[model samples]
Target: MAFSAFSMTGYASHTFELPCREGLVSATIHVKVLNGRFFEPTFRLPHALAHLEPALVKMLREALVRGTVYCTIHIGTLFALTSRPMVSSVAIAGYIEALNEIKKHLPDSPGDLISAANLVGLPHVVEFVEDPVGHEINERILADFSTVVEMLQAERVREGAVLADDIGTRLDRLETAVEQIAERSREVFAAKRQRILENLQQLVAQAGCTEDANEVQLQHAFAQIEKLDVHEELVRLRTHIASARSILGLDSIEKGKRLDFTTQEMFRETNTIGAKCGDAELGGLVISAKVELEKIREQVQNLV
Candidate 1:
């Protein structure tokens, strides 16, 4: 399958006009996303259209994996046709009360300063009633929302492609360093075995040990020396590197957590090799691999 990735951040918006009894009314929908540990969504809808929030959130959850999603739907018109501005009695009463107090404070204030024209112009005193939308128009808005979601996912995929390429390069460097470590480890193991054999022979000779006794002692000592060999750790490290590459080739959007876990495993094996193998050159290679793994970990966090 082709390699694919998805970022947890993106934004998309769409605006269109729908025919209502009050002539053409415009609806603007926006979807914005940010990285998160799970799918979290918030919606802003007009009071008349609040019923659509549940369905819209479900749609986004299915389309995305991990992010803080924000969606807003605004319905309005340039001019009213069937509806007229309505005055709020409560707002006017509060304004008059506040204005009377102001007059008391300033006894010589101009009467026209607190006139009806001023009250009408104030916010919340007069609000335009919105015409109700039919079920058919709501369905059309839902369809347009799906389109915008697809656009957002497409952008995320494009950004993920860039992340995959950069991470792939770092993995390549790590693999090379691991191979070098493996080569150096073999030489270290052979030289250490030779020194152990020489020391054991001298101890056996000074003790006047028989040939059979000397052989048994050598076998027992060599068994303990094998603990310092890094062959097993190197094998596991290569396996982890392969697993990470396999994860990158997956076409699913669930790569981040899995890749992160594999990176931790790589660290585990690399650290073991560094501890067991005391060769300075092998230590340098292990440190280099660790640096590459850290870079890969940072990149995978941005993936979805």
Candidate 2:
């Protein structure tokens, strides 16, 4: 079977209300799949989500096959009316006093430290705002992942169809070559028998054997040589080829492995035919057919 480059990308978003919190949280997720040797997942997330990276990667790896997948998730928070800002007046007063004392000690230094510009730049000095809820975001990401997986499966099926067609064509070519080899081999057998008989006659005459005895021995020799004919190999090869074609027509995930095994059987039978026939042309054709089968095997490895 032959496979094309399979890929898919999807994005989805959803909003859900959190229990005990009178507000909605929204999540947007993007999923992408590209050809690769293994399942490699990458997560580009905000610092707030650093802890969730491991869990996300594990989930994606469990569901995905061979590909480089990228997942991006965005979470947004909507606070309720009751969520009011809480401020510590004493903390703010103490911060100002500490800054004034530092400026008094170092008169040459910048004394305008409590200005709006400096206050804006100070770490942890801003008015506190509500943190975004993320459970709904996680749920939405899972939903989007499900959709992406379905898309990937559909792509694989479409590519498998193309692969099956290509493999069928190659199988047909191989069967044709096998038939040619078998037909030519039958002719070679007749020529071989004639040559063997002539050699036997010359040997008997040189040894001064009587014509009657020579004739009997030559008949026995010819009978023994007939056992090497490849008629059985040809029959088995054709049977295996037919079975392989039937397998290609079926829509099964195991078709790749099954076809590979059948190819091995076909090659075995072809080798047997080559050895039995001992014809140079048949050997060459068998080798050529085996080469094509190997190429097919390589393509099948990437199949489902």
The candidate scoring highest on lDDT is 1
Give each model's whole-structure lDDT.
0.86, 0.67
Global lDDT for candidate 2?
Answer: 0.67
TM-scores of all predicted structures: 0.77, 0.64
Query: lDDT (0-100) at residue 46 of candidate 2?
Result: 55
Off by over 4 Å in 1: 20-22, 75-131, 207-220
Per-residue CA lDDT of candidate 2, range 118-180, in tens?
655555555556555367555655556566556556766676666666777778788888888
User: Among all windows of ten consecutive residues in candidate 1, which has the lowest summed lDDT?
Assistant: 75-84
Candidate 2: TM-score?
0.64
Q: lDDT of model 2 at residue 268?
A: 90
Clashing pairs in 2: 2-163
Q: What is the lDDT of candidate 1?
A: 0.86
C-alpha RMSD in Å of predicted model 2 compared with the true structure:
6.8
For model 1, how does the per-residue alpha-carbon lDDT over 122-201 read when each residue is reduced to its tens digit? 98999887666567877888899999999999999898888888888898999999999999989988888888888888
Q: Write out the backbone clash pairs for model 1.
A: none
The ten-residue window of minimal lDDT in model 2 covers 3-12
Model 2 lDDT at residue 28: 53
Looking at candidate 1, what is the lDDT of residue 30? 93
